[model samples]
Target: MKRDKDALTLTRRIGVFGGTFDPIHIGHLVAAQNAMHAAALDQVLFVVANQPWQKEGTREVTDPKLRLLVVSQVLRTIPGLEPSDIEIQRGGLSYSIDTLNELRASHPNDELFLVVGADAASQMPTWERAEELSTLARLVIVNRYGYPTISSILDFDQPILAEMPWLDISSTDLRERVRDHRPLQFLLPETAIEAIELYQLYRNRENG
Candidate 1:
């Protein structure tokens, strides 16, 4: 299988972990770490979506600049994690295939793995240009708690299943916590919390 091909001479093994990341939380960090370690990725890029298509028309999303700022602030303290604004720079709806294509052109010799949650992987067939997306990079399906069971029928290249400890946290809840002036002490990184406060984000908006 193409996904299983030995990368004996690859310059880098980069994992693309794309998300709306309206607010990047601890769980998001944990999942990225687990995937990188399990898949032996050299670096994991936290690709912030400019406008998440699925999330569009759903609720108000934090500004991309603020979201990217928080991500950069938090990731700066961590090694092996990188903040990318490729999708944000592209502007408009952020699609996985488009991101991968840009990455492919930029890192021609690197092995690219598209890191996604198991729940998201199950819906791979419905993504924009699904068939072509499958060929752009190998898949790393991060499994957590096994609640939303992924069907055994997803046809993607060299799908690697990476298990992650389930964290009972969500961006929605985090946003609410901020809005209510509740303690976010242990929920988000201090840097992220500081950045949020510095920008006065989510202080006046209701969760969508």
Candidate 2:
């Protein structure tokens, strides 16, 4: 019974977790660790977006190169997690399909999984090359509060819902705290905190 239960817990071999990671925080770390343990994934690559289409021309986004550096520092303390700069190197609107295609070519033998939140999964139908995304990776939607569980919308294939821990942390809030000069001793990793201080990130809300 124990062996069977353990076997059932194992999930994917490799998971692709792409995001802005503007300020990688404890909440994001918790989500990734939760996904890895619950799904039994061997490893997860945190891919920081270079030119997030949604952010460009509408919102102020942090420098992609700096974001990548911060993500690497944070992931160093956490095992089974690695940072990928594929999109940063590509230098354009980061598309899910393009990243997945690259991963498939690099690791043809490994079973690939794409990590997503309920919101991103819901917007799949409208994503760039949306039709081809499902073919490249198996989607694993992370559990986030307030958002109802969504399967498939607009004829898109349903993503597998993953059970995760609740963490009330957001980059928006973190930035606000920084702008207000609030303490962030426990909300983020020391490396992330150090990087933010070293580069003076989020000091001025107008620029962050």
Candidate 3:
């Protein structure tokens, strides 16, 4: 029997770039864009964490809705980058395996690429259902300039490496800068900065 060409489902390559995104910064955006290009991803979804289990007791996390809002606003004008509230909607400790499971269920035919930083890649073994990540999606590790690709062994296939110049930016630093009312010029997208200002987010640790 001959199958119709129109009946064939084209497999799309989707990159899942999950993060706390307390306030999406330029580093995060650059990593995702470079990862997408390096991995040949069709699109990248910025999955905002509802509650990052690892950071639960360490410090305060910005509200998930507010974080998602920042992500959406900044990604609005960027092509092939999207904001996903999957973890936020699920309402629990955000786990990569859980998110990948949900994405797999919804997108069975598509190829999934999980993007992570070099630092995070070294700790994959400690993640929940860590061994199952290989079965769920291919890993794409983003390494900053001058940083060597990690040699840690894992069960998954060799990760695709995306290299970019190092940017000295962190969510913690951004939050503190906002708290101190310091200028954030060139650190984050204007849209994200605007959203942060509009929501009066991170004005203080107590309310952040």
Candidate 4:
């Protein structure tokens, strides 16, 4: 039977995985899968942030449209996962507070689980409207191999630590590899790699 794309509206437990997704990699998928299983989420929303406020001016990211396309393409290969254009549509720098608020408004009765890396969780105290995050959605801190298990850093009391294997792949390193013409082999989805090569993405930082 064919699954309905709009069925996310009826979900009870949602996992919001927001990222630049410079190009959706396997690590992103593994982490989301771990979070979904650990939290028993109804579905995971892979939101592509238009402008990552944290990385702003520090590094270069692929064009928003290309990033979104890559994320959307990989998402279709998996069930129980969907790509969201909430931040891209909203425009400007993406903020967790804003995304959570919008989702809460749309899914008032459903429970929202916001997925974050351990590093991101550590800086929650300084986020815009940080205190209100717990009210908007339960935070799930995904574990990394080197980073300490650190959900308690925030005063919010509800952040749960998801102890999952750390997939050492990162977008920054991935981009560097692309610039160096390194083999992407198993790092990212085959289709995504083909698209990147076909379009010559990341070969030139500014253009990428």
Clash count, one per candidate: 0, 1, 0, 0
TM-score of each: 0.92, 0.87, 0.94, 0.89
> How do these models rank on TM-score, best leading?
3, 1, 4, 2
Report the C-alpha lDDT of model 2 over 1-208, residue by residue, as the tens digit. Answer: 0123444543348888999987998877877777677557889899999988877786588899999999999998678999999999888899988999998988766678788877777777888878787788777778775668776544335666675656677887888888888999899899999999999998875544
List, residue by residue over 60-118, the lDDT tens digit for candidate 3. 88889989988999999999999999999999899999999999999877889999999
Highest TM-score against the true fold, candidate: 3
Better of 3 and 4 by lDDT: 3
What shift in Å separates residue 126 of candidate 3 from its native position after superposition? 0.7
lDDT of 4 by residue, 17-135 (tens): 99889878988988898888878887999989899997889777777888888887887879889999999999999998999999999977688999888877878888888888888
CA lDDT of each prediction against the hidden true structure: 0.86, 0.81, 0.90, 0.84
RMSD of 2: 4.7
Query: Which ten residues in a row are the worst by lDDT in model 2?
Result: 1-10
In candidate 2, clashing pairs total: 1
Evaluate residue 38 in candidate 4 and report its C-alpha lDDT on the 0 to 100 scale: 77
Off by more than 4 A, model 3: 1-7, 151-153, 206-208
Judge candidate 3 against the unseen true structure and give its global Cα lDDT, from 0 to 1.
0.90
lDDT of candidate 2 at residue 22, scale 0 to 100: 78
TM-score of the candidate numbered 1? Answer: 0.92
Candidate 2: Cα lDDT at 81: 96
